[model samples]
Target: MNASFSSSSSSKGMMDHGDQPHVLAVDDNLIDRKIVEKLLKNSACKVTTAENGLRALEYLGLGDDQNNTSNVSGLKVNLIITDYCMPGMTGYELLKKIKESSVMKEVPVVIMSSENIPTRINKCLEEGAKMFMLKPIKQSDVKELRCQLMKYGS
Candidate 1:
């Protein structure tokens, strides 16, 4: 193949990959994290999994030494979807932090929980979370995130 042909193909590959939405998923459970990663992948979104809220905060550069963090992998994280009941920090706390962040406040957040508690759902929504979904998330549920992802222009 000629140089031009190879370059064109490479650009095509990048263009397709670059346009996909990048979503950070936080879950304490390994099985749940893997499930979320697979579901998000199937929905055509790039996924990054965090084991707990503190880890997720570190990834977002909101940890103890905020100045030294990577500032979210140098990628435009379009959405954050996290589990509500992680040990170190609950999803509600994470949502509050994100909303408080001047730079990241506008980014949409989705909280997930296995238990469908009304108070928890209401609190997450009132605190600026875009969605509060129950766990064992379906492909269709992940598919629904496309709209939230689209709102961010990812």
Candidate 2:
């Protein structure tokens, strides 16, 4: 996978988040990624982005199976937010991978989708997603997420 492996421009480097939360925001859509990054940064979160699930997995030092994700290392984000309807791997699939990871199992994950299918939402929530948000993720949503994260300590 062609992982871009880059942090936000606002970041000085990998460990420069100070006391702020670091978030990994993944989306295949460029505009959506940028908007999420901007929103997270606005919420005082240091952001890193990935183009898709494979790239996000690579950035997390993970891959297709539990064994592949068993030894994750470096750039650990406090939270992960991914688009549910991505081309290669849906956010639900990505969520399973994250949940399977021993190193990343506790990291809070949020799935966003343009479609509000109850089955899909239930599946994500059942698989351990912290939240399932509708797409066009708003400033208010990010704000609420920040509050939730602070409250839950993820």
Indicate which candidate wins on lDDT: 2
lDDT of 2 by residue, 1-154 (tens): 6648557645455455547887889999999998999998888888888989988887786865545643343545889999998998988899998898788889899999989899999999999999999989999999999987887675
Clashing pairs in 2: none
Q: After superposition, how far is residue 129 of candidate 2 from its true place, in Å?
A: 0.4
Q: How many clashing pairs does model 1 include?
A: 0
The global Cα lDDT (0 to 1) of model 2 is 0.84
Q: In candidate 1, what are the lDDT values of residues 62-145, reduced to their tens digit?
A: 778867534556766789999999998999999998888777888899999999999889999999999999989999899888
Error of 2 at 150 (Å): 1.0
Query: What's model 2's TM-score?
Result: 0.87
Model 1, 37: alpha-carbon shift in Å?
Answer: 0.4
- Clash totals, every prediction: 0, 0
> Against the unseen true structure, what C-alpha lDDT does each candidate score?
0.80, 0.84
